[model samples]
Target: MTWRASVLTIFPEMFPGPLGMSLAGKALAEDKWALEIIDIRDFALDKHRSVDDTPAGGGAGMVMRADIAAAAIDATKARTPAGTPLLYLSPRGTPLTQGRVREIAQGPGAILLCGRFEGIDERVLEARDIEDISIGDYVLSGGELGAMVLIDAAIRLLPGVAGNEGSLAEESFAEGLLEYPHYTRPREWEELAIPDVLLSGDHKKIAEWRRAEAEKLTRKRRPDLWAKYRKS
Candidate 1:
């Protein structure tokens, strides 16, 4: 089945090439999936094509007009089946995880809403079927980057988006731990030799060594993930 994504943003041109450069890009080219960047301005009602309005309480930044954003999301969502959910990228959302991205990848399609200024009006979410997703704890100037990050992570999980099926398991966070060290080319680089285990040619031993290294790296760099890994 083909997986599709619809992105709603004020700046649609910021996408395409960026998303087009990675696995998601290749997926779009190969027809394994489809992605449509819908400009919210297209649904604007005014001559100046204003999609945002001054805050109701006189805030410093303008707020995204609920109706305009809602209309854009609705239009894109109607093109998909009922099970597909619309995702809004927000700083105050559930932190994204590999499992979540995998879940989204299995869907028939999805809609991504990119909020700007002071963010889309809260009423938009109340009126539509949507969930908020945050890539990290940090705030971003806009949701465009978050949407792109989400799409890239989801696309790679699709069949063939990743050229090496084995690679899916080795990448960082694939199984909740960081990836192990990798070595290539000359046995020695600048006098730093490749790991002896990798050169041993014993697949079982190599796998074991890699796992050990991955665990170590996770423990040192991401204790939170390491703690959860141990619990699981």
Candidate 2:
């Protein structure tokens, strides 16, 4: 089945924005995956088409009304393949990871809810059994960017999306470590020579050097990942 991504957001135009370029764009053109955008405001009950309201018990920003949010989610769920996970992009959600992206890439698809204002009402999230996911610790104005990030990650992992499938195994987080540094022609630039081992043409030695460099960089830059790598 073609991997699919359904997004419910107040800004439908925001979708396929950056996703319409590069490898993701190529995969989309080839029908390797599909994208469906749903405008949440379209489900608003009010004649004015307002989807949000003042937060219950009073708060700083408006909360998307539960009724409208639920309606939008229900519509997406009904059309999407059964058991497709429903996700809401939020600050407090679990941090997204490469493993999660791989899981989604192998699945039929996902339904992503892009929250705005303070956020969609908690009741709607609970009622729909949606999982909240975060790309980082910091917050964005809305979930549209987060949804894009997620789709980009998943798209790149889909079959035929990447031109060099073998290279995927060596990417950062592919083996719980940062990717090793890369070098290219023009052996000398700015008085800096390409690493000697890379030019040695000794495949075994080259692999060893790359592994060591990957370990060193991961340990220095991300102790948390390094710790996990060491433990595993």
Best by lDDT: 2
In the order shown, the candidates' Cα RMSDs to the true structure are 1.3, 0.7
Model 1: per-residue Cα lDDT over 11-128, one tens digit each: 9899775788767777888998888889999999999999999999786999999999988887887777778878999988999999899899998877889999988889988789
lDDT of 2 by residue, 97-182 (tens): 99999999889988999999998889988888889999999989999999999999998998888999998999999999999999
Candidate 2 TM-score over all chains jointly = 0.99
lDDT of each: 0.89, 0.93
TM-scores of all models? Answer: 0.95, 0.99
Looking at candidate 2, the ten consecutive residues that score lowest on lDDT are 71-80
- State model 2's lDDT: 0.93
